[model samples]
Each structure stands twice: as C-alpha cells, then as structure tokens.
Target: MDEMQLRSKIILTDRFDETFEQLKERFSEALFYHISADDFLVEHAKEVVDRAYLTSDREKVIVLSAKRFTPIAQNKLLKILEEPPSKTHFILMTSTKAGLLTTIRSRLPVVDMTSSKEEIQLTINLETLDLAQLFSFLQANRRIDAKEAALLTEALAKEAMRSGKYRLDEALLETFAESIRLLDMGSPPHFVLTRLCLKLLERKI
Candidate 1:
C-alpha cells in the first residue's frame, strides 16, 4: 500500500467535493469514476465493479455524488463492498442516511463534513402521538429494513427527550436500547417499532 492511499473504503460526507479533492491529491495515479445521481443504477454498479482496473499500480475509486441508491442497487453492491478487487474503493456521498439501506450504512465509516449538519425536521411528534397516529406514521415509512428502523428509533428517542413531555428514565432508555438490539438480530422493522412505541406509551401512565 502507498503511504498516501485511502485508509478506509467507505467515507460518509456531506461535502462530497472537499473529500473528493483530498482523495484526488492522495491517490494521484488512482483511477477515478464520478457518477452523479442520474447516472447511478444497478446496471451501472455491475458494469463498474466487474470491469478490470485501468491501472494495476494504483487503486480505482468510484465516487457517487448526490445519488440516492436504490435498494436493488445497494444489494448488488454489497458483495463487492464486502470484498472489492485488489485495489478498488467506493465513496458514497449522501446528505442523510435515511434513504440508504441499513446494510450499506453499516458497512462504511462516516466522515464529518466541514460544514455543520443540517437539522432535519421531525415529521411526527412521538410524545403526543397516539396509536392511530403511530399506525399512520408507520404506514408512510413502509418497507424499511431492520437498520433503518433502529435509526428511526434513535431519532424518536431524541425527539422524546427534547419534548420534555415524557419522563426519560432507566426503563425507557433500556427499552429503546433493546429495540435497536432486536433490529440487529433480524427482527422485523414494524414489530420492533410498534413494540418501542408501546413501551414509550408507558411514560404517560
């Protein structure tokens, strides 16, 4: 490995250009493939990953900018991500992890952007939300995987803490933690979320 080679395969960043420039400087001889959102697809990933490296001496890097990778595309990429060709790397750039599948997010190491993170608005207030509202909310977020569910659980927990309406105690925190653990164990997203909500409802009682 060269002294200036990329230390990590996956980099999570909001400032795609800045990180990209740094990579270019580090791997000057490395082959670079820049794919925009419109250009990223399952076929594209297959084409790129299957091809032989242009330069054997240096690495090949694929930078996906502003692209929301579809589940199918990410799945197609999972094998190569786990085991890439001798000197190939992938850089995925996205504003948030919500759209990305849990499998992919877990694979990469996140890099902080130079700029502060943009605050994302909560679509529903979990504290005041009732059973009916919860179902409606879950309906809108259909087909989410276990990891995505865990992320959602963390977001809801944060919102609950900020709301100050519910009491945050050891039990509540433990339940939320368990929810995330269950997600990693292959539990269904809906079941895990629903169970977490029920446990949270206890705060009212």
Candidate 2:
C-alpha cells in the first residue's frame, strides 16, 4: 500500500476518477467498492463494509465520490469508520469538506483536491463591481442555496483582497471570511449575501 493509502481514510477531491485510478494501479489486487453521489446511503455503507471484510484480500479499497452523508447515516457508519477490518482502506471523496461532520473528519486524514482558483461561475470582478453591478449580480443569483452562497462568498472575498479595490484590511477581510464560514454552516443565503454586499459597499473606494 502507498503511504497515502496507509494513513488517510477520507479524501476531499475534485478529480475523483483520477485518484481512484491511481489507487487501482497501486493496489491492483484490491477490491474496490465505488459508492458515488446518490448511491451513498446507510444501507450501502453496511453492504460495502460487509463486502470489504468478505474479500480477505490484503488490500480492500472503497471509494466514495461526492456522497452527502446525512447526520443519521454518518452516525450509522461511525463504528465501521472507527474500526474497519484489517487491511481495509476507504477513500471518501467530496468537492467540499463542509458537509462532513467534525466527528468524522477527526477520524480521517484529509486529501484536499480542491484547487485554489474558484470556479468561473463563482468568480467576481471586484474592480468593476459598483453598487449597480453588485445589485445586478445579486439579482441574477437570488436563488442560490447555502452551499453556492458559501462558495460565492469565498470567491468574492478572495477577489476583494487580491484586487485591493476596497482597500480591505485584515479585520474587514476576516469579516468576509466569517460570512463565508456562516454560509457553510447553513446560514440563510439572502441574509448572508445582503450583509456582505452592504459591508462591501461601505468599504468601496
């Protein structure tokens, strides 16, 4: 087993297939149970764990990609996660680590695959965003959910800091970062965005 496969149980990755393929190469004899998106349920976790132990192979690998584990489901799998079969390995993949609980995160080492640059749709041109443009952008994105809001807030904060358009200092920058964290914790998107917009307006030079 590779050093990464030995230590990390959870992997936060964007290039899911690429990582899986690499694992397949390294552990060629390993039995792989790939549970993705919709297929990641409590029952599926049970099945995967059962199958993992059945193999008796030296290398047992389970790959989960973009699977949103509910609080209940996470609890159900906690035991298995805490103490899996000998020679068993798990790779939990997600676009963001926010969805996973701190309890689960504490048990696993994270392999962050998310890149530094925000997605194009999430990008904001801070230099050109006056009140009118900000309002227009908000109007266009009025229906975003908490996750989208979180991602947008992060991107916006980065743009604001990098552009230095508002001459944002550390305290103000931390406020923007806090807003992003709030969005991640399921804060109302409209309220979060509105407050962020108002703060940006106040500091706009």
Give the TM-score (vs. native) of candidate 1.
0.54
Which stretches of candidate 2 lie above 4 Å from their native place? 1-3, 119-150, 153-205
TM-score of every prediction relative to native = 0.54, 0.58
Candidate 2 to truth, TM: 0.58
Computed on alpha carbons, the lDDT of every model, listed in order, comes to 0.67, 0.68
Error in Å for residue 10 of model 1 = 3.7
Query: For residue 191, what is the lDDT in candidate 1?
Result: 88
Q: List, residue by residue over 21-97, the lDDT tens digit for candidate 2.
A: 87778778777778776325677677666766775646677776753554555666678788888877777876555
RMSD of 1: 11.3
User: Mind giving the per-residue lDDT tens digits that candidate 1 earns over 1-205?
Assistant: 3323474444556567777888788778878787666325687667656653455667778777653455567778788777877877877775444345556767876564536533445567765778788778778766878757866876877777667777665467657656765776798898888788777776853
